[model samples]
Each structure stands twice: as C-alpha cells, then as structure tokens.
Target chain A: MPLFDEKVKTQLVQLLSKLTNPITLHFFSQEIECPTCQTTHQFVEEIASLSDKISLHTYDLVKDSDIAKAFNIDKIPAIVVSDSKNTLKGVRFFGIPAGYEINSFIGACLEVSGAKEPLPQPIIDRIKKIAKPIHIQVFVTLT
Target chain B: MEITFNLPGLETIEQRTIPLDSSVIYDVIIIGGGPAALTAAVYCMRKGVKTGLITLDVGGQVAETSVVENYMGYNHIEGISLVQRFKEQVEQFEIGFLQGYKAIQLQDGTIKKVTCEDGNTYMAKAVIITTGKRWRRLNVPGESELTGKGVAYCAICDAPLFKDKDVMVVGGGNSAVEAAIDLAKLATSVTVVQLLPHLTADKVLQDELSKFNNVTIVYQHQLKAIHGTNSVEAVTLFDSRSQKERTLNVQGIFIEIGLVPNTELVKDVVALNHNGEIIIDCNCRTSRPGIFAAGDVTSVPYKQIIIAAGEGAKAALSACEYVLLKK
Candidate 1:
C-alpha cells in the first residue's frame, strides 16, 4: 500500500489544485547526505507532482550561499512559499509540514494569495515591516 | 553442572601471544531516530557514509502530538502522519535503523564500541547518540492504564482524537502550557493542573494561554489519581499546600511535567550535567573524543524539532571530522 491513503492523497491533491496563487517551494539542502533534507525534498516533490502551480526550487546551501542569502534561508530543509511572480516575500514555513498541519498550510496559502489585508495582525506586521538586513554573530565560552 | 573449557597446554604456553590492540569502527552511527537522527541518516547515506541509527523509538515524543499546527506548511497534522513521513524518508534512503534497540554503553577514544540490549555489538569510528528523552510520567493510578483512552503525553498527537472533548493537562512548563493552548482549539475545555504556585514557563506562553477563554490554570495541585475503567473519564488532584482534594470530570489528560534524559545506557561512560543531560560542546563532541551526542539527550537548549534536526546534522558532521582526524 502507498504510504498515504488514497483518500489523503486525493484530499491533498484537491487542496493544492484549489490554490489561488502560484506556490514556489524553495529548499536549501547543504548536506544531501543529511536525511532530513532528503525527506524535505521528497515532500516537496510529492506536493509539486500534485499541482501544476507548485514549483520546487532546490539549492545546495553549501554551494549557493548567495541564493540562500537572498532568500533569507540559512538552514537546510527550509521551505519558502511564494506567490505567482515568484515573490519570496510570503509566509515562510520552516521544517517539514506534515500531518494535519498540511491542510492548514494549504488553507493559509490560499488565504494569503488573494489577501490584501493581514489575517493575523502580528505575523503580517512581522512580514511587512522589514528592518535592515542584519547579520548576527556570537562567540561564547562554556562557563 | 556446567562443562568448562580447560585447555591446560594452551593456557600454560602464554609466551607472549602478541596482543593486537584493535577498536571497532562504524561509518555513520546515529544516536537518535527522531526527525534529526533519521534526517542525518538520509544525509549521511546521500554523502556515501555507511549509515546506521540507534534510537529508542522511531518518532520520539513528537509522534505523540495529537495535532501539529505550527510545523510550517500543514495547518493541522496528526503526529502519526509526521512520524510516518519521517520513517518513509529513512527507509527510502536505505538507512539501517535498529528497531527496539537502545544504545546502552559507548566506549569512545580510538574506536567506538556500542552494546545494545540484545547483546549484539557494533563497532564504529564515529558515534552519534540520538537517544532522546522520555516524558516524566505522572506515576499515579489509572495514568498508564488509560494512556490511549485519555492519558496522553502529547496534545499534538492525540488532541484531534479528543475533538470537542474535555482535556486536562498537568505541569506548568512551556510544554504543558502549549499543550493546553493547542488543545483549547479543539477541545471544549482545557484545565491545567500545576504542582507549583506559579507557572515556570516563559511569560509569552503564560500570557498567550490567558487569552484562551476555554483554559483554566489550577495552581498548587498534584494529580492524586486518574479515574476511568475503559477510557480516561475523570482526574483527581490534591492541593499541595491545602491538601484539599478536588476531582474534575474530564475525558483526556496530557502529561507535560518534564523529561528525563535517556542517558542510562551511556551514563557511566560520558559526563552528564546535574539534569543528567549528556555534556557536549557546540561541535557535538562529548567528553569522550570519538563519541558524540545530540538532540534532547544533550545539554542544548530549545527542544524543537527544527533545532534537534540541526543539532543532529552538527553531530554527524562532527563525527565525520573525528573519523578523518583519527585515521
């Protein structure tokens, strides 16, 4: 049997097909040897296969730092969901999006696509108000 | 009456049979199988490292979540679904996962030899302890007996199962607070029972919890006993200071008191902090040179899935470095 039931697959496919805007799922995998990245990539592939609007962009974080830097992606297995013109400025989902949360994520994507006004005031304010691109570095000793 | 091998001639002829000092080595020995360990296995195999994972469970506590809301992408997901996805990823990468085996002792230095409960032994040049911790049980009656019915360790894993049901969460930490808040979304009412007078969780979580009208926090209370014959039907708690007894008619209880590190296997071999967490540097190196640890078992702050996965990657990278340097 398939890992996901036919019902779940059908539901997810339906969910993605109904998306109002183009969703570009970007993944930054540094160590392809790392297993989480592989899974993350697979998840992205599954979602991509289900929908025409879903585009998967994978970058080797170790090799393409500039691309990751531009996208504000520092870690591996990080996914950025964007709009029709591939504007990376949207709700960014970190880590794997599996389980019941996938439905909500799909809902959020649909909601955010046509939404001109903020749904959650806090998250919108955090997304809209862009401070200067800041780099943080820290050094500490074990006390 | 047991027979013994008595080779007197060979035993007496101990004329310096040159002992060859040798150590066992592994290409990739993962310490955990949670998101981090399994993910590391996939990475190591993709990088052409002989990968093997030694973990207590496949999904860790994250699997116990009733519903996952904030893990990006999915607005809501069952904990089992997330774990299944993780497991599928590991299997796809051809990673060797030791099911039902716990890494008890790890001897570090030149070579790594790990022993499990089955007496099966493995040698590795690199060792990563992904053995995560277990949630501290309530240790009260009806707690273990009614686990699946109502007593749960994770709200994300089981909250969906309790839709429109009354839920009770024990403990005052961030996990307990978060569980109550998460359950409040699905359940009709969520009651939080805390042993202390005040919550120990961060102010943010406490403040956010206050916003939920369905939530009620009961302070200075301890779970006296869980009641229910078939499934969890109600819970009894005793006021710590007043010693007054109070029972709440509830359908579910999520125990988020705390976690105890699964360092028992390597307790004697590695240095543990006061909390019994394995002591490790930022590089994921334990007190022993060849041995490394990551995830909840280590002393790293923040036990989120993303953070654990990151730490697991660091541990594997560090293990690779140790192998290169030693060789």
Candidate 2:
C-alpha cells in the first residue's frame, strides 16, 4: 500500500516542485526490533520519488553502524536531511515523520533546497549573536 | 521550515510575501496565524498597507481537529489538509510574515510595540490581535509537574506513547470523547470522566464512542487530582451525587477539556468579558483605540472557522481605516 493517497501525492508533488536545488534525505532503517523502520524508509523513498531534486540514500542501522554514528543518529528510523552539497542543516527526524510531521519534513527539504523565504535582518542578526551551540528538537504527533 | 503549494492549474502567481522586519513600522500588525489572523493578513495586504503577521504557528485550533465538514468550500476535508491550504494561500501574498514566534506583550500607543518571546519587538500603527485560544489545563495536582511524564493534552499526538497501557480521558465534550476513542484503539483500557450526568458532545460522537467495549464513561464525576511520583500512576475522581472520591489506576491521562483564549498579552490593555475573551464591538475594535481583536480570542458568538475568518476581515478593514486616519 502507498503511504500517501493519490490526492495527497498530487499536492505533495506540487509542493516539492519548489525545490530549486538538490537535497539528500539519508534514511536509516533496520528490520528487527524496529517496527517503524521500514515504513519510515518507504516514506523517504516515496517523497524522494516525487521530485527530481530529492535523492534518497538508505542505510541499514545494524550493518552501517559507523555511518549512522557519523551522522549522529542514535535511534532507528532516523532521517537526516542535507543540502545540495551534503552539508548538514541540523535537521533530523528521529522517527517516522508521518502525518503532520510531514509538513516539517517538507519544510526542511524546501529550506535546504534554497526555496526558503528570507528571514528579516534583525532576526538574522539575533541568530548570529548566539554564541553557544544550540540543539533544538521538535516533536510532532503522528496519530 | 517552509510551506510551498502553487495550486494545480494556476498558470500565474501573485507577488511573493517577505519576512517581517522588526525595524519596519507596519501600518497594521496581526498577532496570530489561525483562521482569523491569516484572514486579517490577506485583507491587510490587499489594502496596500504595510502589514506584518507574527505567530508561533499558522492554523491554530483548526489544525488540531480531525475533520472539518462545514468550511464552505469542501464537503469534507482533513483538518491539517485544510490548514495546509490556508497556509499556502497566505504564503502567496506579499505580506510580511514572522512565523514560530509568539507575541508576548503588547504596548498600545500611536505606534504600538508588540514584543515577542524572543525579546524582539515589532512596531505598528494599528494592531489586530487574533491570537486564538489554547487548551485549558486540568489545574489539578500533578498536572503541571507531570506534563510530559504522563498527563498530556493532545490525544492524537500522545496516544501512541500509551500503547498497551491504561489511560484516562478527562471531559465529556467532543474532544474528550474523541480522545477516549483514540486511546481505546491502542490502550488496554480507556476511562472517560465527565463532569456532568451526560456527555456534551454531539450525538454522532457519543454514538461512535459507545462502540468501544474497552471504554467506560463515568458520568457526574470530575477529576480531582493526578497522583503520580515519576509517571502517571493513577487519577483521583470525585463523584458529585455520592460525594465520594475514588482512585483509578492508569498510566496515562489525556486532558481533553475546552480551550481558553490566549489573551494574557492584552488582558490589561483591552476590556475582556467574564469569559476572559476580548470585548470587541462590531468593528472588531477593543476598549483601547488603535487596537482590534477577532476570532475566538474575542467575544464572538460562534467559534466556527468561517466566523473567525469573517471577523478577521472586519478587524483588518477597521485597522486599515485607523492607520489611514491617523496618517
């Protein structure tokens, strides 16, 4: 069965068309003990297929443990969205980014692909003023 | 994060919207992103006035709903799908948008200063407040302390966390009944504690709720307290008729009570009704001049999506008039 319905797929394709630059989605999955791993991988695959600018790189969580650690992935079904040049944008989805979480996932894809709206100068300056290394985690409901 | 949707067959698109600037003093600034706030943004942008919209998230209460059957255009649509459409429409305009930041404080004057939680302030000539309501808390013991531990408010978001466990849903409204239904599918048991003798939800919702065999509804019972040390161990319920209290074991609790307006920022500036909603006249103007409010945050009769959108348009027109007159 398809993860996205036909209507949703059409809408998602239109949204993905805004991506001017290429963005890579690195999906990590394992078969055992990880119930949502395959589903999350399928999500990444289907979304990547929607746009030519999107590329999916699947990795086995157990067999590719070193690669997963390099990307700072500590859980199964983790997805790392990188820019055109594989530059990390600090965007990570720990679990299945299904349901409403797809909005944020698509947002990250657009942002990394250089289709993001420009932030105001003051807000930009404020972000630059922060000296500490910040890690922000956002949680979304999938029900 | 960005949201992009250009519609199916639109060969052309309008001018693009830019990010709101703190240095620019807009003619009108809306302080929300719900149906009301988004509608106001469209009106303000169409009026050729410099407008800015500051919100934590677009599509407030409407986004969290499961389905919206009476949104005028569609017969039936998912709540998030409708929200996505609303957001896409707003994204097309040239209105200045500041998403993911809330308007923390509002100072009224010729040029009002709307302070966000990030300490950055945006100035405007006329301010339209559309920051809609939020989920009302349980206010009982351990609710605040054990928010993430066990007591959750969003059933759709948190139901998966209580898989195979017992959970209790508080309230008897549509939200409460829906929470019970959501939990009953995954949890071992679902208990609904209603304050009244019967559920206040619609007949359809009550009928659907009765189909779950694992679900039990206790009428004339109210939640007294949530007792837990680390996580939710149990909940204390109070019976009104018997005037007795009993404890029930549950690992999770979903507080599906009603919502309260997000009027903490403008409570002192605007005159509010007994329900803590801003008192707006027919023009959506508040007690103080140069300030307007709309949607669920105001003393509107109906809290439907269409009503909020209409109120937003009125507020925007009123605000534009105020700014032009002041000029």
Tens-place lDDT per residue, model 2, B189-255, is 9999988988999999999988989999999998999988999999889999999999999999999
**For residues B1-327, what per-residue lDDT tens digits would candidate 1 score against the true structure?**
111111112222222211111233457677666876866776676666666776656888777655667666678777767777667656655555566556677766565777765456777777788778888897999988998888898665567778899889999999999888889889999999998889999999999999999988899989999999999888888987887898889999999988998887789888999999999999988888777888888899877777777887788787777776766
Give model 2's TM-score versus the native structure: 0.73
DockQ of each: 0.01, 0.11
The per-prediction i-RMS, to one decimal, reads 30.0, 9.1
Which residue pairs does candidate 2 place in steric collision? none
lDDT of each: 0.74, 0.87
Tens digit per residue, CA lDDT, model 2, A63-96: 9998888888888889999986768888888877
List CA RMSD, all candidates.
22.6, 7.3
At residue A88, candidate 2 shows an lDDT of 83
TM agreement with the true structure for every prediction: 0.57, 0.73
